[model samples]
Target: MTPQRWVYLRKLLSGFPSFPSSFSSCRPRVFSSSQSAADNMAEEAKKLAAYSAVDNNVQNNHVVGVGSGSTVVYAVDRLAERVRQEKLNIVCVPTSFQARQLILKHGLMLSDLERHPELDVAIDGADEVDSELTLIKGGGGCLTQEKIVAGCSKFFVVIADYRKDSDALGQQWKKGVPIEVIPMAYVPVSMTIAKHFGGEVSLRMAVSKAGPVVTDNSNFILDWKFEHTHNWKEVNTAIKMIPGVVETGLFVNMAQQAYFGMEDGSVKVRKAPVN
Candidate 1:
């Protein structure tokens, strides 16, 4: 399905009683006052990385791909700020419903793959980033669309805080790799992945609602908790080969660069090795 159709279908299904607005509401809540100092530092670091990347890459009359998640929130905010200050002509392509809302909320020009088939750059957030620049994304359940937009872009950049920057995929993010699958095939898909990958597979359940977490594409999520390391590129290919699997969170060799927001207010940049 086209990206635009996915957005429309998500909007339609959102009104159903089975699907709650927030899937992870059962997760422990943290108030701003009760948040630790380190949390505050991470927030600032995210903003610093986002602002720096935008200043360095985004230019006038560029088609940009806006990714989903919390860190991308800061990136969109900076994009809006730049648009206001420099009056840059930027067209944004959203990877999810949240991203589309962000583009509309910030009053930025919103386009799609049909209108702009090729993007200048795509900036997204990752759950974990290893030394080789391999990524584990879709922590927010937008993997399918996020992958599509990133693949279409000439340069895919990742932004994250220090907490998300790790030496390996499972070092920091313990939730495992998110795999979007057709709702009816989740059980079989889970079994197939666990059999092949030798990792615990679980259907991602929603906290606010009584069913599984639904993606913007009206699909279910299966998180594969891998215990050992393997060739990520091979694994990504293998998972995609499975039936009913729409997309996997394993992003291997896709990002051209990554900007990590450090605790000391430094932005560390990593680029993919030239082939």
Candidate 2:
């Protein structure tokens, strides 16, 4: 569905304490009360992409999957707004602890995979998105759950800022693939990945805390920078086979569509080729 139109969630939105405006046909515009907030083009772009995804994909009472990350934060906010404005009875499945919290904070009803295994649609932010729609997620350290939700969804819609769109995944996102591993096996796992792939595999460290990041599932993260790009599907498969590797950030052939908000605040929709 190439719904290229952009529409704001709110028409008269002013000060956004955390996180809209008129649905003017095909163009979406959001204005903030604080000039500083409005000035940040990156954030504005993120909001625009999120709004486009929600307006087009989210149906009333739909079972939705919400993902983690900075851009996705705006997605949750918009989803909540839709729920409130339309009084929609939707159940949201969260991909991480943080995602669950965001859902709760916005007063969105929460469920899990065990309860509702099939998601009507899922929206997430991507670290990188290639021309083929291959993605490198897990920058938010929730790859395992995020992948599960996306894979289970009927429609997986990725929302990212313009900076994430690239000809290839490695071109825009140079941080390498994020691999989730068991805490006990991180050292050996990093070494083994480097030995096989010929790139630096570093245990992802935490900036806020003293040690490495602990994911929602209490797993450690390793960022693997491959020496050179190869067939990413093959690379993803090989990495998943390594012992103690829970999941890789590589999202191969998962996304059905994507919305990239450019620096000029325009959203570009990419659709996978149909068989």
Candidate 3:
């Protein structure tokens, strides 16, 4: 992760209109020229944060947890470059099917939790990160595995564009907290969350496909668009206590650090607030 190496990588990506193949298809549509420029700026910011997080946190011979989404795509690219130049012997543990594909596409060595139960670090992307380092993840439908990997890692780091940094959870990301549940219990779970939390509960539907989006673990997602904010920690615990709830997107106080790529071309680092 040398400065020269980063510059070279940045130059390589500067001309591309989209990110890596991992998420190029899902990026927002640009209507006007001005809107296209803004999209490119956001993509650049994501690359900067991803590179900075990988450079500062990853070490040789470390077992790393590769997270899902667009930001993690750049992290995987940087890791692959370091493996080629520095000859690092790092093992990658993917949090989802997309993560696994990214690892294999880049020719990185891939392992599983069965082989490496402990991890040195886990670098992930979040939908939103509050001041306390509480994260709302699972935008890519990988929340359950992402939380498990982060819980096992010694340190969890988040990378996002400046837009995702917020004072509170729902301020920036309006998609609400994604809740993965058993397929059979979706109706009851939605009703219960609405009764207890007071939010509009919608079953996440698929874009390209006909029905709902199925998770890697064969579960359905319930995106609870909460209206008011409460004690996030308590809400997270209460939601998980539900019988059919597999996992929630509410990552309360899990991240140790977060890197946000700003519009000013500088990467801002935020450490977890001490309790």
What lDDT would each prediction earn against the true structure? 0.88, 0.86, 0.92
Query: In lDDT terms, how accurate is model 3?
Result: 0.92
Steric collisions counted per model: 0, 4, 0
Steric clash pairs (candidate 1): none
TM-score of each: 0.87, 0.85, 0.89
Collision pairs in model 3 = none
- Clash count for candidate 1 is 0
lDDT, candidate 1, equals 0.88
Q: Between candidates 1 and 3, name the one with more favorable TM-score.
A: 3
Ranking by lDDT: 3, 1, 2
Best model number under TM-score? 3
Candidate with the larger TM-score of 1 and 2:
1
Residue range 1-275, candidate 1, lDDT tens digits:
45643453445434434425486662333222224444566787899888888888899999999999999999999999999999999999999999999999999999999999999999999999998899999889999999999999999999998888888889999999999999989999999988888989999999999988999999999999998988999999999999899999999989999998876567899898777
Supply the TM-score for candidate 1. Answer: 0.87
Worst 10 residues of 3 by lDDT: 25-34
Q: Find the 10 residues in a row with the least total lDDT in model 2.
A: 1-10
